[model samples]
Target: MRFLGNFLTNSSRRHAAAILSAAAFAGASSIGFAAPALAHDAVLSSQPEQNETIKQLPHEIILNFSGEPQQGFNTISVSRDGNVLFRGEPRAKGQELILDVPDNVRSEPGEYTVGYQITSSDGHATRGGYQFTVDNPDSSAAAEGSDDAKADTTATSTEGEQGESNSSVPSWLLPVGGIVVIAGALVLAIKRYRDIKKD
Candidate 1:
């Protein structure tokens, strides 16, 4: 009778272990599914789109992204001839970052460049720049104005260049590690249960 009970208990343990192994496999699969979401978001379009010329400098520059950017984690700066006209304090509105040029800094025209650093929804930093020319007679002169635009595109909040934005490691590492730990614990528990059953 005791032998039958022991056999039944071991069978139950194997079944439990099989369930745990299946759970760990599912967990690993889920991690794989979520891996793609870790990619950095990209700029879909921007105000005064790339290489576009404008009659006047718009008070605000808007950037539309492929995904909703993180709030308070983005920036925009406008400059001409390396002279920064306005450093924008960008705000999030849906999938766009709106940077309002300060009143005092507006009105300059010339070849202006917009540089940005933004944190995507998945917590990746993206940085890039685009240029637009402002069509004003004084734009050429303004290009030489005081206070060169902050040319440092890679700010503390932003990543380096676009080429270096991709992550080298796989995103599933953490989740896989977690699953391994859980599986190990489950195995140890099963082994302990067998030891006690044998006794």
Candidate 2:
């Protein structure tokens, strides 16, 4: 009877220790789960300095974020007088997004809107816009006329270089090269086998 009582006490103590340990582990895990949720807020900072006026228009617009975005889901739109001006693909650079603007954006002094939507790593989405204006319309017009010719020339030269580089490689050469190497190896193996058989 004494042995039975001692056994029961020891078993109860062991069960109690296990329950306490499980509770402690669960409490620790619960604390860890709250961390990611707290860090998931979407934040955005954009260039052209919200409401800034510049003499020269920027070739590229940039937006820096607090978190990495979901690929293929982020979008940026620039407009002047409610007409969409730039709607191109955005490239991600670390936590920043760089968008290439159209080369022919009207440099005339007027209010423009830059709108953006970004989805954060934790799936939270954020959206916002800011306005900026060009102060000198005539200056922009003259700059545009001068820049138009230069931009076209630069684009043409770049395209020509790319085309030349691509034309240097014949599409059929890759397969032909592979086949030649395989045939040479097969011929060498056949000769070696014949030599071995003769020996």
Candidate 3:
């Protein structure tokens, strides 16, 4: 009876130790996951200053983020009212996404909204917008030049739409699909073999 009691106590201690070790491991994993979440990319700065008015128009709208953007998923759009002013492929330099402004932008001076969507290197997407105004009072006199700018903006928007329509499956999807098909075929083959043996 004494030996039996000693064995039971030792077993309980071992079980408790395993549980404590598992809890510690889980705590460490939680911290590891949280570190990345806390370090997600965010807007660090923007050109033209949000809500600021400028006397001279900027050549481009620049956005700086806290981290590098995921390639092929970063986008920036500049619009005046509901009409797209500039839209095309976004260029990334370091942690910044740049949208090259068309020269005709100087012809129309009013409030413009710059919208940005960036997918971080970690596969998380972030989006935000800011507004800036051009304080050019003689914008009406620049209407002739504005027509060319408007046409350019329209072309850019059309190109953006076309690019979006060209859809190819993600690179990872092909391998995943092949693996699933192979697994299904194997399972079916095994079942058929088992039936034949049984028959």
Best by lDDT: 3
How well does each candidate superpose onto the true structure, as a TM-score? 0.51, 0.50, 0.61
Clashes of 2: 0
lDDT of each: 0.82, 0.82, 0.83
Give a tens-digit lDDT track for model 2, residues 49-80. Answer: 78888765688888877887777778889988
Quote the RMSD, in angstroms, for model 1. 45.7
Q: Order the numbered candidates by TM-score, best leading.
A: 3, 1, 2
Best by TM-score: 3
Off by over 4 Å in 3: 140-199
Select the stronger candidate by TM-score from 2 and 3.
3
Q: Which stretches of candidate 1 lie over 4 Å from their true place?
A: 1-38, 138-199
RMSD, every candidate, angstroms: 45.7, 29.7, 37.0
What is the Cα root-mean-square deviation between model 3 and the actual structure?
37.0
* Candidate 1 weakest ten by summed lDDT: 145-154
Shift in Å, residue 125, candidate 1: 1.2
Candidate 1 per-residue lDDT, tens place, 80-157, comes to: 879977775698889989988777775655688899998888887888899988787666565655224433433533
Of the two candidates 2 and 3, the one with more favorable lDDT, higher being better, is: 3
lDDT tens readout by residue for model 3, 1-199: 9999999999999999999999999999999998886776888788978999887667878888889988787778888766887776688898888888887654367788888877876777778889988777666657767998999999999999888776555889889999999999999999999999999
